[model samples]
Target chain A: MSWLIDPFADFVFMQRALLGCIAISLGATPVGVFLLLRRMSLTGDAMAHAILPGAAVGYLVAGLNLGAMTIGGVVAGLIVAVLTGAVARFTALREDASLAAFYLISLALGVLLVSLKGSNVDLMHVLFGTVLALDDAALTLLCAITTFTLVALAMVFRPLVLECADPRFLASVSRWSGPVHFLFLGLVVLNLVAGFQALGTLMAVGIMILPAAAARFWANSIGGMLAVAATVVAVSSVAGLLASFHAGLPSGPAIILAAGTLYLLSLAFGPSGSLAARYWPRAHLEA
Target chain B: MALRIRDLTLGYDRHPAVHHLDLDLAPGSLTAVVGPNGAGKSTLLKGLTGELAPLEGCIDRGVARLAYLPQLSEVDRSFPIAVGAFVAMGLWHRVGAFGRVGGQDAARVAEALAAVGLTGFDKRPISALSGGQVQRVMFARLLLQDADLILLDEPFTALDIKTAADLLAVVQRWHGQGRTVLAVLHDIEAVRRHFPETLLLAREKVAHGATDTVLTAENLFRARQMSEAFDDTANVCVRPATRGAA
Candidate 1:
């Protein structure tokens, strides 16, 4: 208890890191749940990778200026997203294949751009993130991104669900499908940019997708999955931060690894569809 | 409100699936579209619902609100949503994306579920339902839509007899409420039994009139023949001159 209490209480940096993680978890996890529901978990990962080249370009231009990097990342991400969608729509290639092509190219471009100007240490920081060294500016950006995500998500909640569940029905009823989908993509890119500040471009999607995949085992409804995913992310953030502090490990991987462990646990023991529940079945309900 | 479709051509990639179609659906008319597998019964509905833009013509629906039920395959049933919440989506026109679901809305949802024989099953996840139950849930959603015009594509194709009959009753109730209903169906007998008007199509309209007249053997055969005669590599159509054309 003291190990958990003392670090957060005494160290201001630790407090900021924790707050940053919690804020990201609140915003990104719900988006992650929808991503999972839409079967776009890998799309989140692809988009995360897609953010790198823009971020790297920002690094090349302005070094460590937060605004420069954030804008660059967002622009690059939206470009990839739009291009991938267009390729899928206009060509014979499907969305997943197009996405894979774009993300791979984006990743290679990012690595090349980073190496062109910065040393290996700066490159490592960009790839793996510097969670422990979050300044007031970085923290404020994360909070702002989270606030926008929550409000936008609230606004698009019903139509978003309908778009995922029954797109044709939604199209028939309202003309909001295209706008809602693009808005959701914008949210995904924005959250990834925020997570990139805390977890790096490479591991940014880890905090999103892992907890969402884990929540699928524990909950049976969209709202329930969202609640469970947010909880998992929050808990994993605390555990990972504490572990990284104690073991002198890199913070981003530690947080992601914590989320990975929770996913495995949920897969094995969660009440809804876990391996344990499957093997040791409950009695049938009396209808 | 009446719907007038003039020279509608709908398809994928500019290759028309439904071609040179002209139709007039009377207000409160209960109509069934019957044809072979590739006869574009679904395409016409897609055109009407605005899911597919017409390649050649227009549908004038006159500001009527529409509720469309695509084939079950179009819906992602694996999505994690409660039966009640899924059904409540019908109130989208009223509640919209941000509007709250009030107490009366909840009661309306319950009534819809009850109408579809899904009483007290509100909390069940849609993933847990069988094919018949899923169809019922879709019907419940339609009940809540409360639209002036309804379109159903293959609504009873895979449903069990009981489920089909129950759903048919719901469709009839919509007719009783003086709403225009158009359904794409395979069971000619069911269409004859329930729907008063029939439009026999095979990528092109074969006949459009009262069910008994339009569903005759000659019309049905012509529709099948026209469907079978479709050319996969055919170029864009050159329509023959109409009677009044110069």
Candidate 2:
């Protein structure tokens, strides 16, 4: 308990890191649950990589300026998301295939840009992130993004769920399907941008998707899944930060690894639909 | 008329899935759209609901609230939503994105569930339901929609007999309330028995009149032959300048 409690209490950086993680968990996990429900988990992963080039460009232009990097990341991500959707809709290529093509290009371009302008350490920071070193600007940005995400998600909650459940029906009744879908993609990109500050572009989606995938085993409804996912994310963040402080591990990967471990555990033992649950069946419902 | 269309040509990529259709739906008409598999029955419904834009003509729906039920396959059965919440989405037009589901609304959802014979199924997840139960849930949703015009596409394709009968009774109830209803159906016997008007289509309007007259063997055979003769690689339609002059 002392080991777990002392570092965050003593170190300001550790406290900031914890706060950042909590902010991210509050916002990103709900979006992750929707992505999981829409079967767009890989799309989330792709959009994460898609933001790399934008952040790299930002770094190239302003040298780690938070505002520059955030704006650049968001613009780049929106461009990629919109372009991928347009290509899928207009051309014969499927969405996944087009997304794969765009994300691969974006990843290569980001790596090349980062390596061309900065040292190896700088490149690593941009890719894997420096969660423990989050400053005032990054912390404020994280909190603000989380605040906006929560509000926007609430505003669009009903339509977003309807769009996911029955898109054609929503389209027939109201003209909200297209706008709601784009708004959701915007939220995904916004959360990824927020995650990128603390987790890096490469690992940002890990926090968003891993806990959501794990939550599926524990909960049977969307609301339940969201709750379980947010809880998992919060726990993983604390555990990862503590591990990073005690051992010599990188914080972002440490956090993501914690989430991964929980995911595997849930896969095997969660009561809702896990392997253990299947092996030791509960009694059937009276209905 | 509740709805009118003139020279409607709806399609994907301009290939004209439903070609050159002219139609008028009266304020309280209960009509069935029947044809062979490729006769554009679903496409016509899509055109009416504005899901597919017409290529060469227009649909004029004059101030009518519309409710459309697509095929069961269109609904994401695996979505993690409860039956009650799913059915309550029908009130979207009234409640909108941020509106609360008031106590009265909850009662309406309960009544809808009871109407569909799923009275205590409010808390059940949609993924746990059978195909027939899911159809019943969709019907309950339509009941809550309370639209002036209702369109159902293949509402009973794979449903069990009892579920189909129950849903058909719901349709009859809507008709009795003087709401206009149009359904795309493959079952000619059901259409003939329940629907007063029929439209036989084969990428074109082969006939539109009384169910007994339009569903004759000759018209159905013509619809089938027209559908079979459709040119997959055909160019964009070249209708004459004037309707009768063609």
- For each candidate, the alpha-carbon lDDT, in order, equals 0.90, 0.89
Candidate 2 lDDT tens digits, A95-154: 899988998998889888988888988888877888999999999999999999999998
TM-scores of chain A across the candidates, in order, are: 0.97, 0.97
- TM-score per prediction, in order, is 0.95, 0.95
* Reproduced native contacts, each prediction: 0.94, 0.85
B-chain TM-scores per prediction = 0.94, 0.94
lDDT top scorer? 1
- Error in Å for residue A36 of model 2: 1.0
Clashing residue pairs, candidate 1? none
DockQ each candidate and list the results.
0.80, 0.79
Task: Output DockQ, candidate 1.
Answer: 0.80
Residue B76 lDDT, candidate 2, scale 0-100: 86
Poorest stretch of ten by lDDT in candidate 1 chain B: B237-246
Our tally of clashes for model 1 stands at: 0
The whole-model C-alpha lDDT of candidate 2 against the native structure comes to: 0.89
